[model samples]
Target: MRFTLKQLEYFVAAGETGSIARASERIHVSQPSISTAIAQLEKELNVQLFLRHHAQGLSLTPSGRTLFQEAKRLLEQAGGLYAAASQMHEEVHGNLNLGCLTTLAPMILPELTLSFTSAFPKASVSPLIDHQERLLASLRRAEVDIAVTYDLRLSEDVTFQPLVELPVHALVGENHPLARESRTTLKELAALPLVFLDLPHSRDYFLSLFDMDGLTPNIAYRLTQPDVIRTMVANGFGYTLVNTAPRSNVALDGRTLTRVAIDGSHRPMTLGLATLTALRQTKLLEAFVSHAKSIISQGYIPGMMAP
Candidate 1:
């Protein structure tokens, strides 16, 4: 009761983030500052709010869970008052912690600033580009406000809003044997050396495409980064599977890569926005989702297999 609004704000950030360090990074505050705030908050409330898990980061205690809801509601009320006073025709304005899949970051994130931030200039975006598992984990932990990523391995706690369907395509170098072909089958693609973009469920998803055709790809190399895989494929290293349809055939090093349409019964992955189902929707989040939907609808967002 004696704690200030700042304390509650910090507490909520810490609880949602599940890590004082990540909370500090996301909010642009020092770790020690949040630590001090948490201490003060606990002292004033006379209940332990977090359980320190050493290197694994913090987890909310039972008391913390109960208090988190109240803290969030109070913060929303306080924020509404602040926004009301600001006027300027109230629009979504706040620091939104955003997560983009590493592969999609190149295509989606760049447009985010132009489409979303340009409209809501008052909003500040803190973007975290990572893999699928990490993005979903961040959402569940409340580390990220919203995530723009593919629907991969989503748990019950997460909600996925599909923006566009980016189907699986074969990426090959200009000089590759299959490069000249306008379209090819998954079976034909499997025979070539595969520069597999190995990342958790993504690797398996690509393999599943081959399985659909009853053919297993000869995965010659396994790399983590999508750009790296593109570079390798562009340099004639091997063929690879990708959902992101790069607008240009150029790679980082100015190499020309070609995407050949598949002639098989392979399932395509959807690029969507993922968020925690339990979190109360905020104006900032709604604005971002709206902007994203518009981007996809308008064909502004890159990496779409042209319809």
Candidate 2:
């Protein structure tokens, strides 16, 4: 073949990242090398793969977009060959693309990844953390092999294996009137100012709790990061609702926080592993699923408090 797999690898990286510099950083290659590979690939294929803008970066041409998808599939297949060879010796060894919910990442990823890698020393994991919608989108694009996320608004193409159920909790400052309470209701929370999580699908889940009670929350602040939301609640800005509670009640600012269980029956978010239904499960993926099932359950999670 005129073009090499290395060339296709560089081309795919450039297409995904939209710039030589970013692609270089992504795959730990030099910018000049990536640029040269793309140039060579385009010349060999006799196609203009990308549209270069002055200082803006590259966008894929129509042909490049089509080839990019093919290249990704080819790379996955190539990786599977390596995994298959390892499996012959009864070993699981390959790169795993692990996606996680942003809010859950801080609580789960570090420990989960470290332990999984320790158990299977030959295997490696790369984590991609994002909101629910983006994580699912990445799965559809084959950008993420598996995602640890909530069962919220899942599409038919995705398959979720439920691991644990996390009930909602209302976070409040130490001096807040509700802090002393062991449990609070949606009606009680709706009367107070709410520090909304404000992520795409997550926001809908939180709002739906109030909707179920036929009440509207008095949204005092809207924030994205979970830690920031916790800090805001600690500082007495407003109460926020969350399913996964950290082990500590103290915020990043060292202020005290309290997790009050939500009263009455509400839909609890089920934390699980989500994968594309059509994608073939490799040995490495199967190993991870097994490991996850063993560690993550209703009684225990890697880094967060048990439900």
Best by TM-score: 2
- Expressed as tens digits, the lDDT of each residue in 1-307 for candidate 1 is 5899988988899888899989998888899999999999899989999999979999999999999999999999999988888865556898999999998898778777566778998998999999998998899889999999888888888989998777777889999988999999877777889998889889878887777667888999989988888889999999988878867888889999998889866677888889999999988889888888877743545554354
Angstrom error at residue 246, model 1: 1.2
- The CA lDDT of each predicted structure is 0.86, 0.92
TM-scores of the models, in the given order? 0.70, 0.71
Model 1 scores what on Cα lDDT? 0.86
Which number leads on lDDT?
2
Compute the lDDT of residue 1 as modeled in candidate 1: 51
What's the TM for model 2?
0.71
Candidate 2 structure quality by residue, lDDT tens digits, 1-307: 7888899899999999999889999999999999899999899889999999989999999999998999889888989998998767778888999999999998899999999999999999999999999999999999999999999999899999999999888989998999999988898889899999999999999888889889999999999988988888899898989998788779999999988988899999999999999999988999999999999988889888998
Q: Which ten residues in a row have the lowest lDDT in candidate 2?
A: 85-94
Q: Which parts of model 2 are misplaced by more than 4 Å? A: 1-90
